[model samples]
Structure formats: structure tokens, C-alpha cells
Target: MIAVFDRVLIANRGEIAVRIIRTLDRLGVESVAVFSDADADAPHVRAATTAVRIGPADARRSYLDGAAVIGAALAAGAQAVHPGYGFLSENAAFARACAEAGLVFVGPPAPAIETMGDKIRARAAVEARGVATVPGIARPGLSDADLVEGAAEVGYPVLVKPSAGGGGKGMHRVDRADDLPAALAQARREAAAAFGDDALFVERFVAEPRHIEVQVLADAHGAVIHLGERECSLQRRHQKIVEEAPSPLLDPAQRAAIGRAACETARAVGYAGVGTVEFIVSARRPDEPFFMEMNTRLQVEHAVTELVTGIDLVEQQLRVAAGEPLALTQDGIRLAGHAIEARVYAEDPSNGFLPTGGRLLDVRWPADVRVDAGVAAGSLVGAHYDPMIAKVVAHGATRADALASLQQALSATRLPGVTTNIRFLGRLLDLPAVVAGDLDTGLVDREVPALSADPVPDADFAACAVHEVPSGHGAWRADGWRLAGARGAVLRYADGDGEAVVTVRERDVVVERAGSRAVVPRAELADLEVRAAEDGATLWVSGAAGDRAISRPALVRRALRASSPELVSPMPGSVVAVHVADGDEVALGDAVASVEAMKMEHVLRAPVAGVVRLLAVVGAAVVRGQRLAVVEPPTDERRP
Candidate 1:
């Protein structure tokens, strides 16, 4: 059948928008993309057949502007609007607005969205229908004291979940009454910031539970089916970083049970298009699961489900919205081989996994894997959206094979500019628990100490000889440069906070303080750090240590920047809020100010207790390492 709409407007940004555009293109349907000023040149905007500017960089004025988005869609002659996940995907008002405008909303019914959008209402709805829900309060407004009393009744160690949002924002675990108030406040603030809703619902915190979610596709007709289940147990900060379909923990019987339950929930809600039913699978119980929440939109890890199901869920969404019956049934659905997806986010796992922003100086991926990338080389991972830059999915006959293939893909992938969780993903895939398919929401958190404890390779300096001078030096001369008095001269290199010197003499290289040495071949002197034209030679001159490669120039520049004794903005973003001012005394680790980039908040904190001298004001823009404030230690204070 022809597409339900001649053109569907993708009211979103980033990889998901691009992903939907690709599907629309494949279906011979024209695609429209509405981008904010911040996303004018984004890959999604470029991929769309028609593009329209909505508003400024601020999401509220742009992506979150329902009227602006509707206007853009109508102006572009779009007959449908696809809110790809976040912004307005589950917004009942937006759904109603689209319906009133006579535009197809590629999602569940507005009533369904309204009913399930609030976690509290969703819990009550599912519970009333006999679906198991975590024990908690569904009521909205109550004093903190009353809420604490509710928590006591429900039991301590309750989870404070924002009733209005998803993606783990404002999700807090309260173990004590004192912590409940703070958790509730923070949850409200984050919920308001992320979803424009501060209402929260308290739930029983299921300890060490595996997050299993069923992907469901329903049509305007009565057909509803489940596309197996995804194991989303591996996460940090409640955001799923790694996901796989056909959870290892579930047997066929259990899978069928969960899938049936997911279908039942969708059937009860009259859900349409694509949605997910998330459940917390107790590690203690294993088979029995409690309903957590439902996402009435496409998911970030949809690729893995697609890989296993061989169904174009987005196409199904469009078709379902187009008034067509679901093409497949639960009887037709069958899980294929295993597939694993690792989200490549622009974040530094070492530093509390804070979002990192920068122009992608270099971005390359392995050819064998399916890479749903949102950014290319030169693409700016700004501070106005989620930091997920790309998703790499690999499919294989077995779970182990899929994991291995994904590991190879991640290891081979290179993203040089901003700090990424690529290396962390590789390590995560290798974790003993991860390898054995033993996982829980806390597995990643539990392994943090070991994952981040490893120091940068000691051979980093020697490796920089290659980073400093890439191949093609001496005008195609492979021989090392001849110094005035030596075969190869000593060069300085920095790694993190330390510096090292390496002496290269033609075919031989010597390290000063490392007490390690490796002899280089005269023909292959560009080892370790430089990529050579195909010769089958090893990249690094392997010594007793591991093969290392690092950019000496980047490291040296980093070292020079770190010499400053002032707190600075970590990336290019606008200072949205400030907490401290000049002459304000702050203790170490106190948040002095916060900058918003890529929609993620980066709070600048005092590294040491001192009097702060503010340099940047709220609403001002700052670049990476630009001083935001100078802290004067009291011990070193001047008399004057």
C-alpha cells in the first residue's frame, strides 16, 4: 500500500530523525524535517527532502514549540508528523494539536498518550487492569512530609520517578526519610527542565533488577503484537548505554509470558503505532516482572529489535498511523539471531560520564557494522541535545558472536575530537559479568571503579612520535629526520597530567623515565601512532607493554591548558545558570555555575575551597577550558 501520507514531518533532531528519514525515503514517501537554529546543518536536516527552521537554539522556542512545529509541518505540505521520541513524542497536547490540524500523528492515540504519559496514571491504569505494578503512590500533589509517610508505608528505599518524563532524568532512589525530600526536589526540578512537568510518582526501588522491555507495534485495527524483548540491563545513570534483543535471562516460556503481557497492556490502552513496555525483572525472581513504564514512541535501541525482528518498526508506525492494519501478527513474529547495540555517546566515562562537546575532528567507523550515525567529521556535538552521537549495532548467529562482532566494531571505530565512551563500551563488553550475560541495572555502576581505574598507557609519549609527525613526512621520505648531531632527536609528549620525553635515532627509539625501549625498523619508523599505507606491518613497535597510539599534539595542547589554576567551562555552551559570584566563598566540589550544551547540564564546581571571582555570567557563551571563575585559596591570599 502507498504511504498514508505524501510527506511526514519529522519533528525531532539527531540520529532518530535521520533514522526516520531513511525509512521514509525507502518507502518512497517524501520526508520533511523541522530543525531548530542549533540544528540547521544537522545530518537529519540534510537528509530530509524539505527542511524548515522552527526557532532558536533553545528547545522550548524550537523543538519543543508545538505550534511552531505544526506550522512548519503544514507549511512543508506534510500530512503527518513523526515526533521521533523525546520532544513531543508522548505529548498528549501535541498529539491533540496534530489531530485538530488534520495531520496524522505517527504515535498512539492522544487519549492513550495522556493516560500513559503520567507514570502514576499508567501504574494505576495497568494495576486496575490486573497488571502487576511496583508498590507506590499515584497521587500527584502532596507535601514532602506526606510523601515521606507514603514512602514509609510502601517501605523505605523507594524510587522517586518523574511522572511526566522518561530517559532517567530526575530519577532518584531514596533510602532514608531525609533523602526523600532532596530526591523529590531534584526529581521535580529535572522533570520540569526536561519535560516541563515537575510532578513525580514514588515507586518501590527494585534492587538489582534487570530492565527488560518489550517492543510492541499496534494498528488502528485490533491487531497488536510484541517483537520479543530487549535486555536493557546495562546502564549508567538509568540511561541504557548497551542493549540486546532476546534477553539471555529469559527462556522461551518466560519470553512468551512477557510478550503476552506487553500485548495485553497495549490492547488495554488501545495503543497504536510503535511503543515499548518496560518492566523491572527482579534478579531474585527472574521470571516474574513488574511493569515500570511505557514509552509511546520509538526507542534509541530500536535498531537491535529491528535486527532481531527483521521488521521496519518505523514503517509499521507510518502504516499504522495511515489507517492500515498491522501487517504481522503475534503468530508471525519470531525472534531471529542475536543482535547487540552500543550507543556511542560524546561523554567522558572517567569523569562521572559528563557530556563532552566539540567539533568532530575525525569520525570513522568499521565498515562491517551497521552504524546509525547522527554526526560526521566536522559535526559539532553541541550542548543543546542528547550527547548520543551514534549507535553501532551488530548481528550474529549467537549472543557471543554478536558481542564479539560488536566489540571488534567498537575497537576499530575512531572518534578523535571529543572524549567518547567507545573505549568504555569495549571494556564493558569485556566485563566478566557482561561476558556471562549476567547483568543488572547496577552492573555498569558496580564496575566503575575497575573500568576507570586504569591509567593511560605508560608508552603514550613514545607513541606520540607517530602522532606528532604522521606519515608523509620528509616529502615521502620514510627515514627519520636527520638532526644536526643525532640520528633522531628527543621530543616532548604529554599524556593526561604527565609529560615524557622520547629519543628517536633513525631505527632505534629510547624512552627516558619509562625505562622501556623499542627498536624501530628503518622502513617502518612511523609506528604506534601513525597509520601506514597497507604493508601488513604492525602499527606500534611492540615492546614489553601493549600497542599504544596517541596524538602527541592533542596531548601537549591538553597539558598546556591544564596548567591553569582556575575553574573553566569544559565545552562550548551557554551559561544558563549561575550559583556563585565574585567574592563568594565556596568549598571544593561546590557547584559554582552550570552551562547547557547539547541539552545536558554541566555544572562547574570549585576544585578547591576558596573565594571565587566569577568570569562568565549567566546567558553568556563560553568555549572549552575558558575560565568561568578564578578561585583564590585562603592560604595563599595576598595581604592587599
Candidate 2:
């Protein structure tokens, strides 16, 4: 087959860009990659045929700058621009700009993007074509008062959603009428910050909602077909955690009905290229699936659909963009084996799932599964990008086999010097509800306490201590031991259950702790991947158990208190809002400030009821564990 285009420029970064470049290379096309200053050394940059630096580290001046992307494409002598999943992929104006510049945009037309990008108009348009949408009050220019009124009419437990943007950003779930006003305010603030549009609508919240989306393909010749559905019910904070093709909840008849509805939705908007039509199905009524929205470009979970259908969705997108007809008909498309994908994010599951960033010391992936990774060893995971670092996809003849394969793949995946959620994903797959194929959007949230309850294992503590503790043979060692025999150093963390007393000798190491004791050979600990911080205060150890971080207990205890009088930022980010001023009286649990990181907002609240002294300034960058505020008892309330 001839190449879709001689040269194509990718207007995105990370794993999706690499994924697209792989397909472009297979089709015998030259790939051009654009990167910000931070991503100049990213994996995608090295994988492309040629790379260009668009702007500085700030995404606004680089990846999200549609004008800059188009200029790079033209300068590189590229015929088309492929906007992979995020950034400006769904921006209608960007599509129009590409067309006006005589560049083929590998996506739907501008009108189609404009119609489906806005949830309000998309809902109305699809409903006009006899498609089912969640019962809601979605319309343009709905004021706050109008939303309040609509919320009451829609009944309690209504969902406030922004008209523009997807990925569950700017969405709030209000379970009571009194909370609607506050949720609406927060939702509007988030919406405006994220998508620059605060327009919101109210919808009846679907209890036990299961997110199922159908993959559809269209050509300019007016042919649209569905490539089965994916079950994306496993989520955290409204973001998908795991996705799989051929949902176990749906039979042949139900799948056909949902597939038809999805096809109708595509035809309604004249959608082209590969797209996903999302639906919200109630666990009670699995047969009746409600249209959620249509993504104008490829989905992050598109790999799963491609694995099951054995179709290269990106290749198809390229062919269609080059004015080719549908390569396969509805009857020709077939679903073979089951495929599952688990998203690996650079986050600490035990630490409230906050985003983590650092230099990746050692990155290892299993060869048995398909791993699409963005970062590698020596790569810096920064705060400017999303937390997702890679995706592990596996295919098997049965759902159980696929689940088991994914679990093993996650265990074998190792990323040191940065925290990850690989262990948590493995545990989630073992949940009885998940094993039985019974899932809902809220399953992850409800089971977070159990899922993140990771206590530092004795083996991990021993390895960390062995790798960090100084040798006792030297008189000038940090251990500073002059006893009759050699003494070891003790290490502990603020959140650790107990201390690890480690004694490193020439031949073997001795590690003792409460309820455990072990003496292992020094060669064993030396072989493990141990990355120490520059300050030598923390050590990250990666072993068969997974990655674990060990901090110097004394240092952490001195910085933090048992009573917790200070409020600190959980991750490195910018202070977006400060609800309390200096010397303001704040009650316990009162929202004092909010830190924005990785496109998510985390509210830091007062830990004690006292007069608060604010330390964080809005729009100022902060580091993880940086003090943001302090609460001191009033004079009258002071005991002394």
C-alpha cells in the first residue's frame, strides 16, 4: 500500500505521539515531532524521523499553541498534521486553521468538531436524531440561577458538567440541594480555568453508572461502522483506570443495539476518522445505554480496540484523511480475543494518589506484554505534564487470562526514583467485584482505603536501609559509633510503623525491626535498584515487591508534628487560591488553600482550630512538603 502522506507532523507529545510515529513509520512516511523545552529529550522526540523545538517548557507556548504547531508543520514540509488525543486535538478552531493553511487535519471536519465538542449542542443534536441522552437540562448560556432551577427540577443528586471539555474535568456531583450552589461555583471555576468556558448544565446522576464507549470509523464517502465496545467502568476521580474490549456485561443482542446507537451518533455529526462515542449505562438497565458524548479524535484507550479488532486505528485515520474510502465494512470487522489495558501513572497511591516527579533512575518493562511508555531511565518526569507515564496492554483468549496477564505485567514493570500506582492496579484487578465483571464508576473511590493501605514491608525496609546505611569500618563514617563492636544506624519515616536498625558489615547486612529480623548478604541488596536523593535523606528501592520510598525518620519528624499544626502542599505545584488570610481565625477542616498540579486541584485545609497564618501566595510555585500555612492557638486558648 502507498503511504498516506509523504510527511506528517505530530501536534502532541508523550506516548500517543510515539504510538502515532510507530504507525507512520510502518506506512513508510516521515514523521515530524514538535516538543517544548521540557520535552526536547523525550522518548517521542527520539522516535520520530525529525524533531523541532517549538517553545519553552510552558505548554501554552508550545504544544497547546495551535498556530505554532501549524507553522512547524509547514516549515517541515509536511502535508498533514495529526493531533493525537489531547492538547488541541478537539479544538474546532485549530482544525479550521489547518484547513485554511492547506494542511490536512487527521480528524473530523471543523463543523463536526464544533458540533460535538460542546456537550450542550452535542446532546441536542444527537437527541434530534432519536439517540438517547442522559436526562438533563443542557442548553447554551444557562445562568447560575437557571442551573439552580434545573437542579431542583432534575431532582437531588444532580451532576454539574461543563459544556466544553471532556475527561471529567470541571464536573461535580451534588447529592443534595443545599450543596448545589457551592458545587456550581467550584465547577464554574474549574471549567473556566481548564477550558476557558464556564457554561454548565445539570443532569440526573446515574446511580451505578458504567462507562461503555463504542469505537467508530467513518470515511468521506459516507460510510460509518462500529468496532465493538469497551468497558471503562474502573475509574478514580472520574478518570478511567482500566479499559477492556468486549464488555462482559453485554451479550450479543445488547452489543448490537449499543453499536447501532453509536453508528447513528457518528452519522448525526458527519464524523470522520476514528472516534469514540461514550455512553453511560446503568448497571440495573444494561440494555439501555445513554449517550454521554463523542470524542472528535482518537482515544487514549484506542489501543485496546485495535488489539481486539486487529485494526490499526491510526493507519485508518491516515488513510481516511488522505481521501481514501473505508478499508473494511461493518461485516468484515471482527472481534477476536479479549484485550485489557492498565494506565501506569507517576503517582503515590498511599499518599492520596498525588502526582510525583523525579528523574527515572531505572525503567524496566516486561517483554510479554505491549508497553507504550513515554519516559525511560534518566528521563525527568516533570510537574508540567500529566501524571500518566505509560500504558501496559495485554491480550488473551479469555477475560480471566487477560486479567492475569495484566496483573503479572504490572508486577514485572519497574520504575525507580519516582513513585507509581503499579501495585495498586494489581490489587484492583484482584477485587472480587472486578473478577466477577461487576463494576461501576464509584468502585475505585469506595475501595481507596483498602487499595492504598500499603504498609512498608520488612524486606523493602531492609533493602532500603542496607543500601543507605553507611559502613561502620571507617572512623569518619556518619554512623559515629565507638562501642566495643560495630554499631549500625537507625532510620525511620514519619509515617512508618517502626524503625529499621541496620548494621552493614563487609560480608553481610543485619536489619532488625518490630515483628521481623533478617540478615542478608550484602551482594543481594547491592544488586537491587536503589536510588538515593541528592541530599541522601531518602532512598527509593525497587524489588520484586514493587517500588518503596524510605525517608530519614528524624528529619521528617522534625519537619512535621504529630498534632499536625502546619498545612503543606502534597505535590509540587502552584498555589491557585488561598481562602484564608494571615491571622484569620479558621476552624479545623476549613479549606485554607488550594494547590493545582497536573490539572487537578487539591484543597489544603486547617488541621487544627486556631488563628491561621497563611504562607502560600496565589500564583506562586510550591514544592512538595513546603509549608503553606500554620495554625496557632489564640492567647486565650493557650494553656501556658
Best by TM-score: 2
Worst 10 residues of 1 by lDDT: 532-541
Question: lDDT tens digits, residues 541-639, model 1?
Answer: 222222233433233345554444487777777886677768988888887888767656777788778888888897898887688888787756766
For residues 1-640, write the lDDT of model 2, one tens digit per residue.
3355899999999999999999999989999999999998999999999998899987889999999999999999999999998899999999999999999999999899988989999999899889999998998999989999998898878889989888988888899888888888888888887888999998999989999999999999999999999999999988899999989899999999999999999999888888999999999999999999999999999989989999999999999999999979999989998999999998988878889988887889987888888988889998887889899999999999999999888888888878899889988999999998999999999999999988776556666655555463532334554422455444444335446665556566666776667787766665467778655677887877678777765455533443688888889889988888899998889899989888889988888899998887998999988999999987689876
Count: clashes, candidate 1: 11
Model 1: residues with Cα > 4 Å off, grouped in runs: 1-3, 453-455, 458-460, 467-483, 512-565, 574-585, 612-621, 634-640
Model 2: runs farther than 4 Å from truth? 1-4, 468-498, 503-528, 558-562, 638-640
* C-alpha TM-scores of all predictions: 0.88, 0.94
